[model samples]
Target: MNGQPGTTRAAVVTGADSGIGRATAVRLAQEGLDVGITWHQDREGAEATAAEVRDAGRRAAVQRMDLTVLPEAADAVDRLAEELGRVDVLVNNAGVGTAVPFLELELDDVREVIDVDLVGPLVCGQRAAQRMIRQGDGGRIVNVTSVHEHQPRVGAAPYCAAKGGLGLLTQVMALELAEYGITVNAVAPGEIATPMTGQEDVDVLTVRRPGVPLGRPGDAREVAAVIAFLSGPGASYVTGASWSVDGGMLRMGPHAGSHLESDSWRRP
Candidate 1:
């Protein structure tokens, strides 16, 4: 879906302060779209991303967003869209996870994960889609899920639950928004070299994961490339699909089940 004939496109990418969020913001800027960047705790990082966007000859707007705050926080999406004139694409990339075992998890922790990972995106998607509908131009929405969205991971009960829910939510949004020419999809990533994974600034190629078909963790840029494609004109026909950037990790389910040599994985 193209924007007004001669106007530049604009996008709002949540969690754009670092990792995949930062990468996606910059990549979209390179695609000739002005970007609205959001940061939860890293204002400096968000500014850096904005600077990169500016360097790419596109406008950038930065906002601090706390997704756990609910419907109020979703307002940031509209603010960014306003600052950038209009929002042609929205990438819901902000998320939180927990490593606590199921029995040890507290209600607050679970709620926090659910708020940031699931509910928050839903509201933000609504905001962006509403604007797109009013503009009368088709739009794009990309939800960043995880491989856990399809499978399970020990010590990540709430995380998996939230992601799985988000996966299905993506499908529903696609179905409903398609009538307005707004396409919704999800991008599921595997282990990536990012701050969330405790691998910030590390070279992914230097590390090896024998179990992964790619033999290494993914890079944030790698994930951003996929997201950029989905946000571009080329992916106008693709929606309600979950594109896995997991180095074939999901395909190893049966292979890994048969190759386990110990009970270590059973512990979280």
Candidate 2:
């Protein structure tokens, strides 16, 4: 687990322009890790995140990466490693959320979700694994999954499939990469107050859904803390595990009721 002299660890966080990815990048930088950030269509937001990381006294690099083109994925990782010297941790946090029902969902939409959420991670993981093996140093790969990886969502057919596939992919990676001393795991979070969910309109507690026992939506920082652990030394023994950060939302069954009954409560 030795890092380069000036840089202890270099981390690459995809979809880091906002939400969980942004929070995780900042947190990792605070922990003394130089970070490489990627954005799909938010260069401004990505640069803003890079500024925050630099303000924390960690080096930051921002790049634009569209993960759908699978071949380009390895090159992105290679570029990050070259720029930052070495990458000791890779956080696959880039993903898209879709709310269309299965029947209404088109093949293209489903493919897009899978390409970003599942296939993109696979491509990144492969590239990182090769580097870790070459470095002959133990490395970490943490995938930012969702509670839907285990529980099905009513309107998000494609998202659920992608996460579920990613959950299994994590385990497969852990098994295969153990020989190379690489640990792979996942962090499945529930309703986090982030731009991904239109945070300004969400009132987790007052809405009072039956399933979420905590009666509140989680903050991105909360999930980032767990991710930081998995990436650090403490979680060396933890691999192939999907840690659920949801507030008991997945635990409640049939009894959970919809909190979005009133049209007036919706965001304008």
Candidate 3:
């Protein structure tokens, strides 16, 4: 909103200590926006991300946030907005995964996943949208979901449910926020070579993922590029959409099912 004519813009990227969140924060900074980075338990990684944004010659702010606490989560948005002086773009990238089976999962497990993944984003988005509405200018909100948003995975009942909920939430937000010139969309990524994928220090290309058409895990920067596009002026007409950055994994459902000869897929 601020970058249209002569004003500067700022973005808040939650869960930006590392992985896709860190990459997106840096990408937005490179695109001529100040960045606000947030972390839950990785303050060092958040500071490093802030350094990367500052290295790009953009203003950067870092804060620790526990998204499970909805009020504090919303407060995190306000804190970053105040620090950056504006909140033109918001990337709700803070999320957690639970790989427990549905029948075996404890109530706490499912609730924690939902609280952080669904409710936290809902609150944070509301807070950011309110600020954007007050600014009277257009803004962008990109929710980083997962491939599971569109499909189910084994041993990840809570993660899948939370992502599915978020997918629909993105659409509803897009519909409601359109009046305020705020575009809401999602980026659903597949197996990426991040800490979440158990290969934080390894090359994504080296990771073997035959199910993906790309035949390997994706890099965090690849997903960040897609997120950056949605947040930019070029995607003005795009909203209520989930951009899948999964190396065609979703498209390989039939092939994957047929190729699986073991009962391993059924066990989870």
Candidate 4:
């Protein structure tokens, strides 16, 4: 609440080129927050998201950042805050996933996923918290996680491991940052329809999976709405929690040694 009194609230969202990140950026802008959008490789898409933010009558700043580099992640947050004036919210939504068997997975690939999903968020969150504390205002940090954070996936060993670690990390951050008035939380989305997974081929409603009770893939906006709640004033008391948006996917029993059909759902 110690942020600029008359200036609009600002947020920095990484991986905002497309999918959940893009949708969250637009949604935050619509909610009257200026947004700083970052893209890993999709400059055009990031610009498009910025355009939408501008059209919403909010300020937008777009940047290119590779999350694998910790310095770059911290630098991006600093740059966003410098350009946007202030960052009241930071969304760690950038991540990578691969569908390789655990035994067959390369060490390099596993390390890459962990670096992006874990270390990257840590760097960005630390930078954001530093600014928030210095400004004497409270801030929010929302980590975009996956259902795999609690539930394991057969072909997605690295993703599950990274997300599980991220879940714990969120809790630790929430506890440590509490004194600074910064809240840390996570949104673990199940299956959201986004470009990261070939959107055309995914039928969330039609996919007959025994796990997901909703029997449908979630929409990016749905996840974005939850993130908005946490980023906004309503969730001031909510911290150190990873809200699962997986439509009950993690509640299913684990049937090991059972041969299951390839469920080609991808995380965005």
True-structure lDDT of candidate 2: 0.86
1-268 per-residue lDDT for model 4 (tens digits): 5376787889999999888998899999999999999998889999999999999999999888898776766798899999999889999999999999888999999999999998899889889999998878889999998988887878998899899999999999999999988999999998788887666335556655543556567778889999999999889999999998866666645532112233433222
The Cα RMSD in angstroms, rounded to one decimal, for candidate 3 relative to the true structure is 3.6
Candidate of highest TM-score: 1
Please say which candidate is ahead in TM-score: 2 or 4: 2
Error of 1 at 265 (Å): 16
Model 1 clash pairs? none
- State every prediction's TM-score relative to the real structure: 0.95, 0.91, 0.94, 0.91
Q: Compared with the true structure, what per-residue lDDT tens digits does model 2 show for residues 87-174?
A: 8899999999798877898998889999999999999998888888887787999999999899888899899999999999999999
Ranking by lDDT: 1, 3, 2, 4
Which candidate's lDDT is highest?
1
Clashing pairs for predicted structure model 4, backbone only: 204-216, 204-217
Weakest ten-residue segment in model 1 by summed lDDT: 257-266
Backbone clash total, candidate 1: 0
Of candidates 4 and 1, the better by TM-score = 1
Off by over 4 Å in 3: 2-5, 257-268
RMSD of 1: 3.6
Candidate 4 residue 262 Cα shift, in angstroms, is 14
Q: Which window of 10 residues has the lowest lDDT sum in candidate 3?
A: 257-266
lDDT of each: 0.93, 0.86, 0.89, 0.86
- If the candidates were sorted by their TM-score against the true structure, best first, what order would they fall in? 1, 3, 2, 4
